[model samples]
Target: MSFLTFGVGPSKLSAETAQDLRNAADLQIAEISHRSQAFAEISRRALGGLRTFLRIPDSYHILYTSSASEAMELTIQSTVELASFHFAQGKWSQYFADIAKHFRRRVLIDTVEWGQKNDFRNTFVPTEADLITICHSETSTGVACDLADIRAVRHRFPSTFLAVDGTSIMGAVAVDIALADIWLFSVQKCFGLPAGLGVMIVHERVFERAADLIARGVHNPGVFNLPAMFTMVQKDCNTVATPNVLGIYLLAQQMERWNAQCTMESRERETREKAELLGRAIEKSSSFRFLVRAPEDRSPTVCCVRSDPQTITSLHALCRAQGIELGKGYGKLKEETVRIANFPAITCGDIQRLLQVLEHVRSRTPAA
Candidate 1:
């Protein structure tokens, strides 16, 4: 739904709040030159806020790109010399593998069904694999890869690099930033901001790997290579290309707001409460059943619910006509399930209204 894509303004559930656009207007962030000292200050504040909010370690460096997919392309092209193994938890994680394949890297994946976890066991990982990728939150299926499982993979495959995608839950969840050598995400979903900014938090080892690839004369250092991006990042937090200046400013503002008002722990507690509320509501509904049946498999941010195709269609139209919006299911579940984004931008009042609408619709329609 449009609301899932910045349709709901300041009330977002996570690091976003009201008066953001007004504050931007007051500061005139839009008019500043990218290389100017003013933009540099903005960039520093934004990076600083991200470090504070995400607890990024000193061992890692953050890079900016046009989008998260670009981050995948850069990482894949630069570090992967021989092969890359993927935990294809859902469509997005699979997309990471797809990028590596596009670069001609031998790709191997342990594909898992929707609503299930990936096998972090050593049996699935290859010794020759240069990098291992996993999606911490699978937005499509509403399932998550356990951080413990990831850490176990790390211990077993100590030499291979690890990459984790946090696209759908970065701002809303507390991630152990050290769990992977590379962590990437886009701003739209959890950060509750408009799209076009992609962030990659990379471990120093990733740079070493990229450098090794370069020395071997086999590296594909796309226009925005790791070393080059690192150089620009050191240039007072500047980016390689003309950056997403507005997105960075708004993110810094939102990060500062979140830092002042909400601890990540508290934000997670709020997320759990909201999830529980939605879970109960879904359990009680006659026409709507959770697509992911297990409680542990459900995402803290994206909730997927299943119903008949007709009910799903009716619900979409009903929610649409009332100015309420919900996320649509992806892949094979598209027509049979509806997604409820549990982003903080969506308030409890919004949830109640959505539930009321859902209940109202269900009362009149028979379940399959």
Candidate 2:
């Protein structure tokens, strides 16, 4: 049997975006120096548009990185001092802890069950720690933490910086950058752009602190070089090696489109509606169920599903035959779950088509 399967991320690019990519390719010329006016202008525009799209505060400065993981590494490596507290439950959250430990930063980890909610008020966070990191949405398990609740916890520790990985939720959801000291993400997820660009909106205070650390020669600034990043912004150029020119261009254009049609408030409402629609469909499907149970805590962009891996694998094969590629569950949850992304670009018709395909797959697959 053949049908389109719903899975997380790298969703089918919109035809308009595809055309924009083709246009970009046509415009590419050899030896367009990164320092030249052409590239700097592009970088400047992309940064401005991204900040506007994300509703990032004017006090927060924007910086570019190669990927979200790189942005995470930079933020963690640079600002994190002493033992930091990490909220761990999902795959990427676990990695956040692991990365911090690799940086030789002491980790105070709080782990909840895969599909369970974490009350930051209950978590034993250290007051002495300088940084606390959490994934805004854990794509692997489809658990999205309440940013407002988490920020309330941060308020208890006035000195600690809050860094959130908005990788899976950014544009599709509403995140108050003011609540968190660092909000970082990549273009591939909600921005509906191809991979290769990562953005970080950092608080002015964090930048000031980083600058002070650099002056003291006490902090080792690895990938998160605040000084260098600030310099590039002044130059109207993106730092951290050569920027992804084409990705930046496409992202800027996409942001422009998003502004023209959908604002954050509208995007958030649309995402909630789509996720509800899809979640209800999955709940009704006897062959499949949600990995994350609650809509309130679920990621609007990535829906992790609970099912037999073989069943999911078969369904994936069936979908591919129909020109639809579903995302596989990552890491420990691979066998039991699959992910479905429902962001802005994915239309209501897309969800309807996916549901139709899933129903067909269910009817054909024998009951286990």
Candidate 3:
């Protein structure tokens, strides 16, 4: 039997956690009264705890949904009044742009070559539009954008509300909620919980815009309605219709536990250390090269790598045989790249094990 490889999230839960979840299941509340005071308290505290962990300022508002993708859709469909500027190079980021097009929104898309740097600052202006979207960490290529750089660009557009998809980096990486109008992600990714819940931090100004759109009847009123969500969230009630109560309970417990041990600084350091450790191995391995064009822009969580196609194939086989599953390259970049996730749950030993397998695989193959 091989050790489980950590590619994305949902690798494993803490030992004590599994027990707690089983216990909660035994005492599971048969009737989930959404209006119950108990549920309201849970929702209230969960939002407070989540916002505290994210270091959201008083100017921001927090909300919950079924999934992070839902949060993204809500933010996009509700208040995207003018035009949207999308800076994307990865498969997932490209998908967000497609989502905007499906809604018939005016979209300006700027794409850099895979692994290349982009200057969104030069292309954006306050006069151009008020709705701008960006991805904080691109999992597809394991590249991260500088948040400070992005924030600086946003400073030029005081009226612009920035929407960020922070799926792979929110809890694991430090984020300033003030820099964004809408920052969203799922519990499955960085929160290290089950995938059903999406946590969103929205600025009050953005909420106002959403409300205005709702009043004007310009925004869709169904699943993507932010105004309706805001009402439920403000009252600490459920607008989610039917929530995954067990999953959310697990999330709440995990978030509280994570809050006690995981600070943004410390977790970011851990992420950096793991990335550096694996990067050293990659640098020393003559058969491998990082897929990201620049070292500074590479992500601490997702590590994208490249090698000769045959060698990459052999390495993949070796890794899978050894019980270390790797992520395949995405979209136009698939043939030349592979991705490894160094999420918080993945230990240093895990990285070492994968490196050992990689080295062994390289040794058996003839060097190009």
Q: How does model 1 score by TM-score?
A: 0.93
lDDT (Cα atoms) of all candidates against the true structure: 0.81, 0.77, 0.75
Prediction 3 global C-alpha lDDT: 0.75
Residue 11 of model 2, lDDT score: 52
Write down the TM-score for model 2.
0.92
- Lowest summed lDDT window (length 10), candidate 2: 1-10
Candidate 1 deviant stretches above 4 angstroms: 1-18, 363-368
Clashing pairs in 1: 11-345, 12-344, 12-345, 13-344, 13-345, 14-344
User: Runs in model 3 with CA error above 4 Å?
Assistant: 1-3, 9-20, 29-32, 124-126, 363-368
What TM-score do all the candidates reach, one by one?
Answer: 0.93, 0.92, 0.92
Which model scores highest in lDDT? Answer: 1
Answer with 2 or 3, whichever has the higher TM-score.
2
Tell me the tens digit of each residue's lDDT in model 2 across 336-362. Answer: 677888866788888887787677656
Q: Taking the tens digit of each residue's C-alpha lDDT, what string does model 1 give over 158-212?
A: 8888888888877777888888899998887778877788899999888877878
Q: How far is 253's C-alpha from truth in model 3 (Å)?
A: 1.0
Model 2, residue 215: what's the lDDT? 76
